[model samples]
Target: MKRRSVLFSITFRSAVSSDGCKQSFIIRYTSAGRKKSEPSTPIHVTRKDSGELGDHLGNGHLGQSVHLPKRGSSNSNLGEDIDIPLNNPRTSSEPPRLKFTTTSRPLVTKILSSSDRHPSANCPNRVGAYTFGPGEDYLFSEDKVYIVKNDRIISSDSISKMFPSGPRHVNAAVYDQEREILVVIEEKSVYGYKRKGSDYKLESVYPKELPSSIAFTPNAAIRWHDKHQMLLSNGGMFALYDEYWNKSLMTGRSSSYFKNLPDRVRGISEWKNGKANIYTQSLVFIYDVARDNVAGEGVSVPDFLRC
Candidate 1:
């Protein structure tokens, strides 16, 4: 099993000033389950010209103000002299400090704001959304926000988690309407439950698939249809399965390409025309299963797609 590497970036702009800096990184994985991370260039603090100093001055607490340079002395030449403000004790350091101002690419913004934010105490290393289950009757236990409604925990626990205390976030959930079952996918394993009296009963376990995300058809009562089926994409590939499970559809376009996609694929949504949409840091890829084509941009989409 060959490991792969992907690109990731983080932009930190001084809310104060404008020195203009950005940082990027690379993540590599090994077949032995070991991982290596490449650090990004450091970004210095900066102050924007638009009265940022005044804003910080007004607030007794100037958050992240270390990025700003002080005002220059009246006797110094504008270009030759450093702007070292004498009044502020905080800016007393005489050493030259490089500063930077950055804008988070819309894509990175989306990734950081992922919808999954809960971590089960037992599974602290998971990331994303998950369905947890079969707890004592009438007791619902989700990573966050749990409630029991109609004696069913599926709906209440099916929501996504954006932040988890552990290493990963729970990212996948499947609710069965026919049996009122809930399937959950965490970082390393999958669990399933079926309705039993007022509580759920443990059923079967799906084989572990490393670093994958999952989803089910929108309606529990109606399984995948010729119209549109629920799809799952780890951002590396996609799988489509029906109720019977007799036929499994798998597509991985440009195996080498998607295989090396970002480690953090934020969202996977099924689109009409047999295409699935995959989102990562500042990028949205449209994967056409029917035609085996892929197209997308590393930019923020307009409101239409968001709605």
Candidate 2:
């Protein structure tokens, strides 16, 4: 079955500085249906040197007329058409012309080396809980609490730092609003510093006898729980910790240890009905934390959840 997409033009008016007139307008069009409950799309207007309606810029101008090919009544391949009216100003013609700007699929290729890439990058495991920054610039990795900016770690050191020690863990960092601090969670301990003028002053260290698996709860809260909470797993479980790293609110693991199963914690989330979701390699299990028992069958996340 063939689906048809219709394109329509929408224009916005702004006063051109040269003419000092509000009547002059720039128009934009798109066929995409109802963008976020708003019909308007951005218009790109390149002013011609002459500043006239009919001025023939080298390639094409806003008001130039285009001629359509005589084949199918409706066309999809833009190559078949000639100069259609750029802004769809009416012209005497038999076959109606379509005014479309030339477009091409942008080509992108991976440039990072295998050693430089993380296992989680561009993978289905992207199902990890995330906290989006003010813009789409960075996501806070609860595992580490560091800033993952542009899918790369933000460093206090230079790129050469990667040669000796590799990239700093952005996953172990979190921004604290209450204290205005950036907390860094290392493998076996937690450390934080206050922002004093332009430098970071050392804060207290929380040594972990057993590091609880940490996950960011909804409403931007942090939750930790682990074997101390009687949840047993091979690798570790996800949990939330207080500022002092005292205890965990929840944990993801079987109440009794499984000898055959190497239960490594993957991700943690809370869904509707007071349910918390915990992910292992190939399974997603629902836990009723209040009751402290596994509640639902595991569902597999698809292989294409990568970003």
Candidate 3:
């Protein structure tokens, strides 16, 4: 197997001071597995008045603040800068100690704040996830679904209205992007909804009262794999079901793999190829579906995903 190397670039910026002494440094590196190698030393650069920074060190001197590109601008290569404060004392002979941090693109650009619209204490088990349909984006929260455009909620509707009998408390929810379907599991039933315009139309509902080979508790971590058209749930045990809720695989309670899984599963997600990431509070297990065994386990959940 050919191992791929991932390239990473980090930018460090000093906090703006009253004296306007701000500095920005860029570091580029590549990593494969546990080995990491830096391609170049930190390049110090200052920004021009036009909000673009010159990469060459001769363009600007150190201790000068650089203007970052405007938010949502086309030329914005670097995202939000992690501000490193230089308030601590440093000897003149020693280089200024710098702290490095990470920043990601904002998940929600606009704040959806409303006293009555917020998550309620009465509905403590609210489930939400991002789903897209047609050319529009949407966010499903509990019984309500909101139309999101340009990372902002533009409109909202109650999906419960489409239900036969109002809204049932959702236990877990996962969206199948490939199939354009949203599956929501309630306490006593599993419901599938198809995207219809800005709203979701109820398509199928499987009652839990029916004898099921796979049992799902309230704490089960559910994920839908569109490639296989299968639903996976992991509570205290592991199980796999088809789109119609027919159980295809179920690990026995006494299985060695089931015995090793953590008591509380935080979540489950499809990983690279045919593997799945089973997340616990402290660790994540990479399970290969074909082999029906764990491929690997790691304590750093984010690092595993990066690989």
Candidate with best TM-score: 3
lDDT rank order: 3, 2, 1
Task: Give the TM-score comparing model 3 with the true structure, all chains together.
Answer: 0.35
Model 1 lDDT tens row, 4-48: 433223232222333433233333434454556765445444434
Model 2 spans with C-alpha error above 4 angstroms = 1-121, 124-167, 170-184, 191-262, 288-296, 301-307
Best by lDDT: 3
Model 3 stretches astray by more than 4 angstroms: 1-159, 162-166, 176-180, 204-210, 224-235, 252-307
Estimate candidate 2's RMSD in Å: 28.7
C-alpha lDDT (0 to 100) for residue 142 of candidate 3: 58
Estimate the overall C-alpha local distance difference test score of candidate 1: 0.36
List pairs with backbone clashes in candidate 3.
Answer: 22-65
Candidate 1, run of 10 with poorest lDDT: 216-225
Q: Superposing all C-alpha atoms, what RMSD in Å does each candidate have to the true structure?
A: 33.1, 28.7, 30.8
Candidates 2 and 3 compared by lDDT, better number: 3
